[model samples]
Target: MSLHDTADDAEPRGPRGIQSIEVGGQLLLALAHHGRPLPLKDLAREAGMVPAKAHPYLVSFQKVGLVAQDAGSGHYGLGPLALQMGLIGLQQYDPLRLATPLIEELAEALGLTVALAMWGNRGPTIVRVAEAATPVHVTMRHGTVMSLRDTASGRLFAALLPPERLREALGAGLDELATDAPFQQALSEIRAGQPARAEGDAVPGIHALAVPVFDSLGRLVLGLTVVGPGAAIDLGPQGAVARRMQQAAQALSQQLGWRGSA
Candidate 1:
């Protein structure tokens, strides 16, 4: 079943009278829509509950590992149990299996390195890679952890992350980095759904273009990226690459029964 179906199957029907359960359900929805961890106040606001009333439900969720509290930031995110549940639900769709051939086709067509990445606790991890046949290529080994602030794929993934969680992941005081005009511009572009590129950031002489992949409910689940030698594929060609990658991602999402707008 798709994520939506799984959620529907798990949802309680006929309206139970328990206030706690209702609050918990609302909290879950807020987290899903936010696509990132939220602090107590923000989560309460999103759920339409006051912090005092929401605390008990959050505490219960934490105890059950349905939610996690960040040690450094004290924010709450879907915990290991929630992730396991999502994975269990996603396994029915087999995203990686569905995405393989699409990545291969993208690599062949563009003659560039193509990759699919999924977000993890730390950052986006390269779950799959299809290298170009060309002798000279950008090398991103499978299982590479992308920097949330740097590479093209990383920027797109980070853009989908919750602002608070993103700040935490980027460490404190991003304003220092904001002083750099290029860094600010890159971030602005990513937020605007435009592709981003950087030289010698992720890999030397490598340039990359990336697009976000959304699931059935319009939640970002992964990123599709193509990278190659700077001369072979520059920012000028990114639009073409992005179009193809978006098509492939949409197809893969459809195979996974995603019904959301791509």
Candidate 2:
């Protein structure tokens, strides 16, 4: 072939990667999937390779502190460097940053505004808002602290957050709220995996449905809210908007490492 033909053939459609490195990554992925030490044979089987083929990759991984072999059982597990990398990845996982694009997509798809709220020291606070193409008549804004008893987002936190955190957030108010029947009932409904719904209660002309997003520990990380004019969106717990929000929130939760059922 001519030099020009050789050059044309060598041009890549995308960034070229080391094939051996990709093969080695499959072993690492298998280890992560099992979440426990595996014998060489089992590890190789999981990686879709034979033990002999997987040994050299494992040795290289050990040298880099990515995998460790148990002295007693000779089984391999993730090593210190892998743990460090995982922690660093988790530290960089900002829920608000990750959810911005998702909420924007939700807003566009549903034709309703979407908001992300997280528990602040004071209470549930709106951290981000994605406005719909057609603006909804609502009073929500970034940094708005939602009413714990009056808003969908607030009630979602009240229901799904850990009891210790709820106590800290409520303090003395927890004792008084314990006896409130309506508040208890609302929380029970939310704990059953139903999205919190408020219709013209928190705001005169707005309706909202809020769902919870969780992390690897199954802890509530944030609340996703869909808001629109009362006449524009379905506000029922089982409505199209609520179902769509649940699906979206579940997907986001999975991205955040949540392995629990929705």
Candidate 3:
């Protein structure tokens, strides 16, 4: 499906095979995938090249502001130019458009319903759902405003969203059965990187696990939740399905120019 892999006639090639560009790409990939600044030696090692060869490329990248070295610590990370490129990529890119394919794949792979939600005019709304082959009796659908305290998708925003947005969501979909102290404690735990969970809280006999997606500015953009019958879904964040769900969310986050760790 890659654009570069389409069928084409064989063409003449250079002897060195565009070595410098290839090396530059490898180094950039290393920096991006690592998600943090790296020392010169470590960056070189990650790209499978010695410092002697990598340094020259780094210097060229630095000149163009694609990479920047810390003068004191001697570490290097993505510079302004690299961030500009990422920002430009996201300019016309829609996260949902980028994530729908991933959601469908996860639903098929896990045999469950994958829901994508975002903060809407009224509250956290289910914007899309990708369901597996098996029939599910749940009534959730597009435009449904999730319960701020009952739905896993809603709680994901409560955990990491800004206070103003949280207030708006609460006004729109607060759960009557929710107790304030317990809600605060649960939000604290969820904010500590736990996937939000709700069983018989959103839908009777239904359970869900929600993983968060954040933008480059560290703002919550959407939640990816997997839903199924309580007995069929793995509610734990550590389980196989949850891990795969997290991976999919991470992929979408990256498309939005989010580099998870500083």
TM-score of each: 0.57, 0.85, 0.79
- Give the per-residue lDDT digits (tens) of candidate 2, residues 1-262: 8999999999877888899999999999999988899999999999999999999999999999999999999999999999899878777888888899999999999999999999999899999999999887667888999988889998899888877897887898878878889988989999998889887788788888999999878989999999988887787778899899999999988777777777
Q: Which prediction has more favorable lDDT, 1 or 3?
A: 3
Query: Residue-wise lDDT of candidate 1 within 144-245, one digit each (tens)?
Result: 888766788777766666666656656564556557677767778777766656566877887788877766666677788888888877575346766677
Ranking by lDDT: 2, 3, 1
- Deviation in angstroms for 170 in model 1? 3.8
Q: After superposition, how far is residue 33 of candidate 1 from its true place, in Å?
A: 22
List the global CA lDDT of all models.
0.76, 0.90, 0.83
Listed per model in order, the count of residue pairs whose N, CA or C atoms clash below 3 Å is: 0, 0, 0
Candidate 2 lDDT for residue 164: 84
Q: After superposition, how far is residue 133 of candidate 1 from its true place, in Å?
A: 0.8
Candidate 2: list runs displaced more than 4 Å: 1-12, 230-239
Worst 10 residues of 3 by lDDT: 169-178
Leading candidate by lDDT: 2
lDDT of 3 at 114: 91
Error of 3 at 67 (Å): 4.0
